[model samples]
Target chain A: MNWHLIAAQLLNGLALGSILALVALGLTITFGLLGLVNFAHGVFFMVGAYAGFVTFQYTHSFGLAVLMGALVVLVVGIVVERVVIRLFYRRPPEDQILVTFGLAIVIVEIVRAIFGGKTQLFPMPSWGMGATNLGFLVYPNYRLQVIVIAAITLAAIYLVLYKTRLGLIVRAGIDDSLIVNILGIDVTKTLLAVFVLGAMVAGFSGVIDAPIVAVDPDMGASVLIESFVVVVIGGLGSFSGSILGGIIAGEIISITTIWAPDYAQVMLYLAMALVLILRPQGLFGTEGRL
Target chain B: MMLRAIGDRSTWRVELAVAVFLIAFPWVFPIIGGYANLATRILILGLFGIGMDLIFGYTGMLSFGQAAFYGTGGFVTAYLLSTGMLHNTLGALAAGTIAAACCGMIIGYLCLRQSGVYFAMLTLAFGEVFYFLENSPLAKWTGGENGLPGLPKPVIPLGFTTLHVQSNLALYYFVAILFFVGYWVARRIVRSPMGAVLRAILENPARAAAVGHNVPKYKLAVFTIAAAYAGIAGGLLGIFQGYMPPDAFSIDQSGEIIIMTIIGGAGTLIGPLVGAGLWSYLREALQNLHGVGAFWKLILGLLFIVLVTLFRRGITGGITDSIGLFRVRRRTAAAHVEEAPAVSGEVQP
Candidate 1:
């Protein structure tokens, strides 16, 4: 094994895994709290990228772009939750999945209509340009920043979910929503908050990932699937599992690329299948939780 | 007696009506601006949607990886025919159908281990696995992004005469016969003892299991059957178009069929066909209209949301419910009239 190639791929995997973790984190939180599948979660990611793209075009400020991306998706999440998703709470899981799937198509088509089907270039911020020499290996500045951004966001979300009172209610709701409602905690507000929070996180990750990957209406499709694999491997609704699953998925894809690039994606699915066979709950998932 | 017989579930009224519609569709559809090709596409999707309805509508298993079987069947049949490895189209189609069914069996086995969202995600992920395999690793056979092109249309040889499906109309007839058969078979399954068990499972898996039905076995069987249906549809698509596109294995393909099934109404059997017709017709019609071409999917998506929210029973379900309500009202009215005359006669006496 070539140490240099392996090391580089490992780092690349970490970067990829971090993004995957960010995306999956949102999905787990929503699934845990609301029991909603949220198939349209990826559309929020795509929307964020487009919002950031439009923002960057005017302001040329990465900070503003990120903020706009998150804010726009947050609003979109609110309207979607209020108008459509709110009605689905009492429905079966299949109904929720179907509605959200439809929502995803609608959102993607709208974006395609506005931006056209062509891939848009999201140029790296001025500060994030050039490579960083990290003693043993050189890495792009934007990618390193992405890792930092994802890590910081993950930490921030952790604090909110664990340390805050709202987090307490959310976690309690996740355990047994009916009981939480019986205790007069107003689970509806919590559900909306958690759903929007998940959407914002997805959108944030989309914008952050814009420079690294192509920004297009359908860009979220792969990320969405990969995150599903991550959520599955980590165990659904397991917070730490998202992180672990994401890294493992990233490593699998990157490392496999060394020998057979085409099989990188196939390897990820195989790993998921293996995990399903060995531990259906996932690495960090609780049995029968979701 | 005749009316009651026609209304009976065992009666051939529904079948006769469906056959009439199938025969009249080609002629009547033209008045509303539909052609043979569009109708044929609808039939293909309708055929695919029958399996979807079985597993999803009646059995309550929502699988998003049906494209795996569809692509498998299409590619296998297309590859066999295009490469001259198979001379007979019917034989190739049979092989493709079997291949898809086998794939469904394996996939269903693993995916059935989980229920609800987990199952949906597993199926979707597994479907992607097939897509990636087809696009890159197995591109030699599948022809990758360009897809497998230049396959001959279907030709059937009997002991006496040969049938060549060379024209669009001929192909439509060929597919229509297969679709009718598929529909008839699906209707049988929906009315079978196993079908009752499937419905019971759908209503309440725990109760169904409590009643001594093998829920998993039923699910697996239906899932496999659905895959077979998808496979045959895929084979027909390849033969109809004379080229198999790689996107046949895509998530969109899987999603579209689901949309069609749901739009037409799940559990209604013929609901999928209605949904396919509406979906295909609208898509074709909308794409032709100025300023509305791109928005057709958007409109459909909105319509889907509305249907799922307000009309979960779907169009067919709604219509059937209304008809049943109307019959009940008429019977009640007649009973009241008869009672009124008897009461009046007693009072006068």
Candidate 2:
């Protein structure tokens, strides 16, 4: 194996892992808090990119684009949870899947109808346009920036979850909802806040990554599936599990590309299958949590 | 009387009415700004939805990957027919259906291990794997995104005389017959011992298992059966269009079928057909609306949300439940013993 190429692929894997980590973070929080699989969470990501796309059209500032994208999606997340998804809190899982799946379709189709079938482009900013010199591996400067930004955001989330009273209540709710209810904490409100936070992070990731890839109606789909896979692999209810699973998923995709590009995509599925077979609860997930 | 007629489906009147409507569809559709092709498409899709309903509505397994078997059947049969490897159209279709069923067993074995949400997610994963395979590695034979084309129409040998079905009108009859037979056969399965077991599993699997019925086995069987139905429907799709579109394996197809099944009423044997009819009609109608155009999906999405929110039992279920309510009100003077079925579909849990 060429050490230089391996290093490049490994770096690329970390880059990919960061995005998965961002998306999976939202999924895990929402799933843990609400016991609802937000299928439309991916659409939030797509809308965020589009939100960024539209914002960039007027502002012409990359930072502004990211901010606007995240904010728009955050509002979208809140409204959607309020009107549509709020009803599903008491509905059966099957109905929940249907409503969200339908919402996903609607969102994708609306985006397509508005944007047409063409891929939207977002260029790398002049400040971060060039490659970064890392002795053995020269990486795209914007990707490096993305990594740092993602890490900072992740750290912020980790601190909020671990340090804040809200975070404590969230953890407490997951462990013992009955006690949390007895304690008179507004669990529903906190869950809504958590869900919206998750959506904002997902949207932030989308807007941040928009410059690197095609921005289209269904762009969030594969990312959404992968994030779910990461959550499952990392352990559905565990925060650290999502991070670990995201890295493993990112590495698998990137490493497989070195040997065979086509199989790189398939490798995620293989990993998921293997995980399900070996440990159905996932690596970090509690057995009874799911 | 109308409610009673609909509520009590023991008679063949409903089937007869359906048969009559189908027989007249090709001719009737043209006068109403519709075509035989649309009707044909609805029937084929309805056939597929019926199978999905068996798993989801009746058996309470919300599998999100019916498209795998569907695409498998389409590609297999499309390949054979286009390559001239299979002369008999029915034989090629059978080959495709059988291959899909076989594929179902393997996929089902893995997916059914995890019940509830896990099964649905696992199926989505595996189903997507098949889709990726279609687009990438298996692209050479499957034609990747381009899909297979140039399939010959059916030629039925009627005891030394052959009947060639080519025109849209003739094709409607051909497809209708197949749909009717499929529906009839499905109805039989729903009435069998296995069907009872499946319903038990749907309503209460834990209790059902404790009562000596093998839960996993039934789940696997129904999953495989659903796949077979999806497979046959897919083969028919290729044969119907003469070219199998690449979207057969798409997540959209799976979603569409589920929507149709739900809209028409899950658990109802004919609910999917009703749902397909309504869904297709709506799709065409919304697209044709002057201001809507591309916004039809947005409207439909809103409609789906509204439907799931208000009409939990769907169109057919809603209608029957209303009738059931009316029956209860009017028959209050009499001793009410027999309860009206909750869902329009007999198999619905």
Q: How does each model score on TM-score?
A: 0.95, 0.94
- Per model, how many backbone clashes are there? 0, 4
Clashing pairs in 2: A235-A285, B267-B345, B267-B348, B268-B345
How would you encode candidate 1's per-residue C-alpha lDDT over A1-290 as one tens digit per residue?
Answer: 78878888898899999999999999999998999988998899999999999999999999999999999999999999999999988778888999999999999999999999999899899999999898888888888888898899999999999999989988998888899999998777988999999999999999999988979999988888999999999988989999999999999999999999999999999999999999988998888775
> What TM-score would you give candidate 2 relative to the actual structure?
0.94
Q: Quantify all predictions' global Cα lDDT against the true fold.
A: 0.88, 0.82
DockQ: which candidate is best?
A: 2
- Among residues 3 or more apart in sequence or in different chains, the pairs in candidate 1 whose N, CA or C atoms overlap within 3 Å are none
TM-score of chain B of 1: 0.91
The interface RMSD for candidate 1 is 8.6
CA shift at B88, candidate 1, in angstroms? 1.2
